[model samples]
Target: MKRQQPAQIKGLKKWLDPVYSAWTSIATHKLRSSLTILGIVIGIAAVIALMSIGRGAQAQILSRIQGLGADLLGIRPGMTMAGGIRGGFGSASTLTLEDAEAIKEQVPYIAALAPTFSSYQQLVAGNQNMNAQVIGTAPEYMFLYNLEIADGDFFTDYDYQRGSRVAVLGANVKQTLFGDEPPVGQQMRIGGNIVRVVGVLKAKGAVWASPDDAVIIPLTAMQQMVTQPRTSRGERVVTSIALKVTDQNQIEFVTQQITDLLRSRHRLAPGADNDFNITSVQSTVEALKEATGTMTLFLSAVAAISLLVGGIGVMNIMLVSVLERTREIGILKALGARERDIWGQFLTESAFLTLTGGIIGVVVGCGVSVLLSRFKVMTTLLSADIIVLAVVVSLGVGLFFGFYPAWNASRLDPIEALRYE
Candidate 1:
């Protein structure tokens, strides 16, 4: 066994020698190698950065929607058709307080309801004046939006009954109208009517039309001040109604019940188009997630085109390397080096080039992600899977494009190669 140790050592040296030589060849041509890897670095970095932003946006959207309560559902007036033109959501005031009341009274699966009316109006608080979204909703508006009173109290049911000119300020509204001073108890003029401030809401951050930038008042007061439509049933017209389900599992059942109830109330015949639409938190979230996922995939595909180009660049450089080292390959074959050894050496060089560039690209992408978020440009999320993908893709590119050049070197006729050189 001791005598055979020398042969084993020789075999190991033979295997390692080619890898070491490949490393040496790449190191000696630092400038050429660097330039060749630049395309790959750029491609991989772009893919990661764009994907990180997509992932972060998706998470934020899901979190915001989830925070609104999974059991929550929103009911808005259906599309309005006037002549040939089609109006968008809430264009017609078909929903009324009577509808909200009926749902609350008849729907056993419902936990709560907040009938709401909204319009954009200019608000004046002493010297500060700004245009803001004014919402007329029930006292449960804060609960529906997951908002808390930072100071004072929300307007009471008695205030709504009397159509009192009282209001609750959103975080942004408070900051804009009151500055550093207390907003509660201060009077603000909205739609030319002076409404007393009853409370200020806690910061909930900004999402799609977030309540953080809105002003809340009683539904009755809103109709009285904002000129909302009045129904023949002597009930106030509302733009939408928010409902809370007793159980998340009962969402579909409750939705069908609501549809039946509303269609009957609207006097629509069987199979007739309804005048209202009910949207659930879960369905909305799933739709948004699907859209975001598709967008991310499309953008990532665009970015990957650059990697394809980079692979072509790798092939070009490897071919050049083979030509430049023709005599070296010939000398190795003359010294009894096998064709497999030649192939392994060339393949190793190509792999080393990609692996190094891939590592650098990852660092670059992460740095760009950090910078974008630091400047508040946009959000970015980097996951372990993304990093692994970049490395694996780079290695795959090396193997795919490097094969032809490596094979060409391995198949060279040593006598012809030496004679030509």
Candidate 2:
């Protein structure tokens, strides 16, 4: 082992010579190297920026879906046909509190359920006023929608049954209406009627229905006190019913059960379309995931085309470098440099150039993402793994594109190279 050590050291030193030589060659051409590196830098930065938008959108969408609860289902009044033009979803209010009560009483495998009623109106508190969505729901609405009380308490069953004029303020609503003062027990006017604030909800960022900007009240209070009954749906109306299943596996079966029960109760003909729509939050999430993921990949592909362009720049510059260094290659070959050594030297230079650019590109991409996020254009994210991946891809791109130039140099005849210029 001791006798073999010196031979191993000699071999290692011989291998390292090409690496240092390649780096020296790259360092000597600062202007040319910088321009080549800039191409890769722009390509990588574009990739990071575009990918972040897709990923950020995906994250926000998933959060909103999760806020609805994992096993939650929404049963909304379906479209309405008027004057031969079909109105869109939520255009009708065929759902009722009785329907919710019936589902509560009859449905099994249900973990939670609530009646949803809502209208958008400007709420007034003293001299302050802000337009917000007024939501009328049951006691379960807080837990069902993943809400947490920041101050007082949510309306109880007694409040709903007695049709009490009590309200729960959302974070933004509280800020706009009450400012820094304690909001609990304060009176606020909705639809011109004074209602006492009972609780304030913790900050929940932009949700699907903009619930963070809503004032929550009891269903009975909303029905009896403030708003008039809609001429089309009349009294005893609800916008939708939200339910949570006891088990994830039982979701489809329970949804089917609810569907059949609703049809049977409504006494619909076999072929008649139901006036309501049932939607699973999980299904919505999966569908959104697929859509956003596909869009991300497509945009990423478009951005990645820039990387190929950058690679071509690397190849072009490397070919020029080879042409300029023909006499140097001949001198090295005459001094006992092998074809593989010449190949390795150029390949190493290419890898170093792209790798350095990749590191700088990551920083530039992150900076661009932060700026974009500041402007609220879209969101971006960076992970350690993504950074590492960009570097690996950059190095691979450099190696693949730099190969032909290196090979051409390695195959040149020593006599011909030495005689040139």
Candidate 3:
């Protein structure tokens, strides 16, 4: 007669018997199991929380930059470099209002462009006096920057043509000068020149550039009343030109055209570099992505170290478990349990421990993320992919660390294991 098979077990219920037994064994030593799982829980939670914070920072930065305008380009003065290093600051007179007018006349893709001139001046309102940066720009500045009026209206073409002493109050400037009182129609002294506040801009919130910190006035008024007297060279000048492109896709083309035109006008040779720097949304986005990528990598590495420690803890605990269960292992072996069955039982126990910790970790990480979002600190976008990945990694840690102990237990001789004290 053939040797009787060990009771012909079948179906999922039969396969789960060993798993159930392993779980019971772990439950008997509740404190030890909970402590072992706590390490994994903390580690996985750290990984998820840190990664979410990094991603949130990236999103916030990108949103702020894009909020300025996707189709805008900024031109500032810079040196022409011959070799690897920069020579020095380029000519101060490189960019001019004439160039801005030429671009408005020549480039069809250019929707609007404004020449900006600025200075820090003491602004006086009744008995209130505060020093703030004053920006000089044409009426078109409002449209180019998407600045909206909270009260009254922006200065018009007639104001620019007449060179009127009209000003627009930035959000913070209004608060400083008038508090809760309406600033529209109020006359304020800027550099001893009285200018009427025709418009008060709505609060734009604090942005990276902080536009709310400056006071805006007609370009002509600023050039004549504020800037010309201070210029030793006696040249009425503007600092930089901000341009709004008709289409985002045409930014590169328009930027190149503007560069070539400005270079030619500035008497730069074909081989010589231009005297102005052009900043576009695309360039800003690329730089931000690179910086954020570096930060993510660094944070991930730090979190990975925690995960490694958790893995080691699991391995150590599993080894101790094997030694503690030596008699139990021998009893099963003596009852004719196969080596594979012993391995399966231990592996299941280890996986269940880690899986439990991982589930709890995901919940805690997401809870923290939600709290952060509520406080307007950052966003935590916990997608299905990340959740699945966390689970897989947790299970992988259990399997990887549990293998050695499981194998060692499985290889024990039945007679020796039976005699183990």
Structural similarity to truth (TM-score) of each candidate: 0.83, 0.76, 0.85
Once fitted onto the true fold, the runs of candidate 3 whose alpha carbons sit more than 4 angstroms away are 1-22, 80-92, 228-237, 296-300, 327-345, 375-381, 411-415
Q: Per-residue lDDT for 43-140 in model 3, tens only? A: 78877777787777888788888777889898877764556665555335567777778878877698888988888999999888899989888888
Ranking by TM-score: 3, 1, 2
Q: Considering summed lDDT, which 10 consecutive residues are worst modelled in model 2? A: 226-235
Question: On residues 1-421, what C-alpha lDDT tens digit does candidate 1 reach at each position?
Answer: 4555588789998877867887899989989999878878988888888888888788888887798889988999988899989999877778888999898888878777899999999999889999999999998777776778899999998998899999999999999989999988888899789999999988888576478799999988887887877867666788899988879999999999888888888788998888899998899899999999998888789878988888889999999999988988999999998999899889988877887778888899888988998998988889999999999988888888889999999999999767656
> Compared to the true structure, candidate 1 yields what TM-score?
0.83
Off by over 4 Å in 1: 1-21, 61-66, 121-131, 175-181, 186-194, 231-235, 287-306, 328-345, 371-378
Question: Residue 385: error of model 2 in Å?
Answer: 3.0
How much is 383 displaced in model 3, in angstroms?
3.5
Per-prediction CA RMSD (Å): 3.7, 4.8, 4.5
Candidate 1 C-alpha error for residue 42, in Å: 3.6
Best by TM-score: 3
Clashing residue pairs, candidate 2? none
What CA RMSD would candidate 3 show?
4.5
- Local distance difference test, per candidate? 0.87, 0.85, 0.82
Better of 2 and 3 by TM-score: 3
Tens-place lDDT digits, model 2, residues 282-353:
888899999999988987898789988998999999999999999999998999989998998889888888
Question: Once model 1 is optimally superposed onto the true structure by TM-score, how far is the C-alpha of residue 139 displaced, in angstroms?
Answer: 1.0
User: How many backbone overlaps does candidate 1 show?
Assistant: 0
